[model samples]
Target: MIGAVIGDVTGSSYEFDNNTEDYDLDLFREGTTFTDDTVCTIAVADAILHHKSYESALLEWCGRYPGRGYGGRFQMWLTSAVHRPYGSYGNGSAMRVSPVGWAFEDLEITLAEAERTALPTHNHPEGIKGAQVVAEAIYRLWRGEWDKIQELLISSYGVDYERQLPGVGVFDETCQGCVPLSLLILTKSTDFEDSIRSAIHYGGDSDTLAAIVGSMAEAYFGVPDTLAERALSYLPQDMREIYEEFRDRFIPTSSLEV
Candidate 1:
């Protein structure tokens, strides 16, 4: 979870101006902070930990943190009284679905919860699939099944690993574009930080891309202590508390620590 937050914060500054030329980019820049990605991830974790609906938790958290770079449609949904899904297939579904991967041990249950997280807003089939793919990747990595991930992606999702990534600074918010790129980046990366750099190098929705990749990288490589602490610093006390609680309850102490 902290890994996702780290990626969101680190990539926040680069969301608009991607560092296409610098793989050794600074992890954080001036004024970098958490965004809707971190907030929604926390909401997902809170919903699972406290047995609340995804809609209610998202409303409450999003209400608390307005103007954190939420998508226009999501912002409208946030303020409107009507709380039904708007059938979006944006990468937002995958960006916020990281916690679902950590909360459940069973793959079927993980995919089910991932769908539940997406349905409250991103009800499109691609939206739901994006969420499931990220969660399933993280769950598999968490279970130490990383070796089979490439096969799963190719056989099930038909990800063309050999295809070139999108051009730099080309922002694609849809799940179809972002999820496969994130998975490809993960498959090619050498470590947690390298995966994030790869996402940034490819440009386009940097924060969301890094968030999705970071969640899987954390499960696979484990977040560095320095990076984890830096990410927690950006989160407010309440958000930090929820993260701590979720971390304690869901993640094993041996695998990760903040």
Candidate 2:
């Protein structure tokens, strides 16, 4: 989704060195580039669009984008001829699952699809759960259940959005740490850009966190036209084409209006 891509590009520069809570901070810097988050997200959308196997599509895309700063286990999987689940519980599962939320009409189907997508690599229970929770959140947001969004996340995933955690700049990669924070950021956001800024403000694997937040925020508030165009400019032409086609097929045009 464009939301995930925009978040990935925006947060790429802040992954290390500088982490801030300043919402007015520059979103895109000179060295910013799409990472594994955007690559895998596009892979998921490609798989769904072409009716191909998730594993195969993921493997192909990972192969195509070898230097996209993938996580260790995922990097290994990309190179290995043997494709097997590594039982990882990293937030990678959740980061790449936004497409599942959009591809299905029903919540149950979206959750199931998310689980299936994660199982090929992140077969750990926590990984699957993380993907399912994010996918379900996006699905619910798309369904326009904004009023009960916090209640739904709390009751469903036991995520305590109100609990105070470490301050921004503490890096955490575990699904438990990042997913909840990403959701909480979304809860506090005022718009699509704010959602990404809020997530990045939390630091620690910022791109993945913002990608997760941005995906849900896109469903809830829709992407701003200027923001979307700026984000698209960072993507390759092929990716931009896929994104356009995917959005045309799945998201209604009215939902994209600012």
Overall lDDT per candidate, in order of appearance = 0.87, 0.85
Model 1 lDDT per residue over 1-258, tens place: 877898899998889986458888887778688999999999999999999999999999999999999999999999997987999999999999988998887999999999999999999998999899889988988889988788767764575644534556789898877887788889899988898888877788898889888988998888888888988899999999999999989887755842
Cα displacement (Å) at residue 46, model 1: 0.5
Q: Could you tell me which 10 consecutive residues in candidate 1 have the lowest summed lDDT?
A: 159-168
What is the C-alpha lDDT profile of model 2 across 131-247, one tens digit per residue? 988898888887888877787668755755445344578777877777777877888889888898888877878888889889889988999998888888888888888888899
Winner by lDDT = 1
Q: Candidate 1: lDDT over CA atoms? A: 0.87
Ten-residue region with minimum lDDT total, candidate 2: 159-168
- Give TM per candidate: 0.95, 0.95
Stretches off by above 4 angstroms in model 2 are 159-166
Candidate 1 lDDT at 80 equals 90
